[model samples]
Target: MSSSVTSPERKKIHPHKFTLWVAMGSIVMMFAGLTSAYVVKKSQSNWLEFPLPKVFWYSTAAILVSSLTIHLALKAFKARQMGRYKNLLTVTVVLGLLFSVLQWMGFGHLQQSGVQLFGVGSNPAASFLGIITGLHVLHVLGGVIALLVIFFRAFSSSRKTYSPVSIEIVSTYWHFVDILWIYLFIFLSVV
Candidate 1:
């Protein structure tokens, strides 16, 4: 009797998600260096201190809410509840936009409070704060774009497959940015 050939299926890595991970790893390393420098620079006598704006707290809340909505959206997608998924995704997108607005408001507050972002009057403390947070916003923007793509896809005719990979990957990223902001906020507030 001829034995049937058996071959195990190899797990295929999602290219977009794989690229995101690699990019995130680079981001983590970049932030690590920035924070390290921040710590070292904080010890310097010339390091000027500034209070973090209250609007940042608002942004934090908005981002946290977005995280929840995205999670719900993912569940909805997995359950094949397309309508609920669309609504949740829309809410998440709105929340993300709100978070960005709040962050901008916080930055404006910083400027109003005399924490300049550049040139002559700029302090190391404020500079580092702006740089780190701005970099994070760039990543968040990327996530927002990804979500928007997913959102549009959900509305398209081809959405019936309802695969959870893309949504889950973006959810991971959204939560990462949320947690990263919280960590930075606490770090700046304390140190």
Candidate 2:
């Protein structure tokens, strides 16, 4: 008789992983279509030229900070440092909220700066900017909700036994959203 310890074949995937991947892929496609349209429409005629809002730079910096905080939180979770993980998660959540508020203020600043979005079919560029940022804001709001869910979950006793996969997934999604915003900001700024 052959005395060999055979390892079980690894299962292909859990259902949750499939769902997460599908969601991520959908988000990628949505942003890709938006950016492509932005590029195409920007090349056309009669686009208004206005100064980009100063608040945008502040919002970018806030998002970068938030990304770092979430990364630290992930690392802490992996290391089993529950205290540090909680602290970092709190900071990341705060930063995400701050980014949203800054983006809102940026829109207000644009209005105050006499950058009209739409009037008499004028300022097409401003209108596009509003639309793109508005859509981005909606996505960011979703991210904030995701973060809140993660935050509340961390407080539950069951959370101690839960795998860090959900937290990691949220971090990945948040970072993707942040990078997308940065790309859109740069694209709008230059064009």
Candidate 3:
């Protein structure tokens, strides 16, 4: 043979999953930029540092438990345990909502403690905290919405679409948000 060429095969990821990963990467970049700015701003004047509210811990616990429930839900889906999966998914959705509510309460605590979130007398530090945590809560709400879709689908008597990939994707996104919150909590606590 005069010449021989060989190409290695590439593994493929599901388009939906690939899209989710890309979106997640973008989210990471956005948070990274925001947190970086936070650190830099901290060095400047008029940056008031306040204690993170105790409710944040409760929210963290809620999200962590939600992550567990989502993980279990995915497992149940894979095992064809529809009842368990549906129950676990319901718990995950409730926990997600609880996390969001706790986060709002945490902000209330901050406001009560004289940390103005925004407006004429707001401190930059408190403003940043509000922006970052609020964005995270929005992401959690998005996950909750996704879970609700799956939850409703699971219970639909008209059509039963038991797509494991869909469940897996939702589970992955839920875990991602959960971990992101943990990272943000630690970052806020330390720096």
- Tens-digit lDDT track for model 1 on 54-158? 988889999999999999999998888889999999999888888888888889998988889878889888889889999888888888998899888888996
How many residue pairs clash in all the candidates, one count each? 0, 0, 0
Clashes of 2: 0
Per-residue lDDT for 37-85 in model 2, tens only?
A: 8778777887667888888899899889999999999999999998898
Q: For residue 73, what is the lDDT in candidate 2?
A: 94
Colliding residue pairs in candidate 1: none
lDDT of 2 at 44: 82
Provide the global lDDT of candidate 1 against the true structure. Answer: 0.88
Query: CA shift at 103, candidate 1, in angstroms?
Result: 0.7
Q: What CA root-mean-square deviation does each model show from the true structure? A: 2.3, 2.7, 2.4
TM-score of 3: 0.94
Q: Each model's C-alpha lDDT?
A: 0.88, 0.84, 0.93
Candidate 3 residue lDDT tens string, 1-191: 58877788888999999999999999999999999999999998888978999999999999999999999999998888999998999999999999999999999998898889999899989999999999999999999999999999999889676678889889999999998999999999999
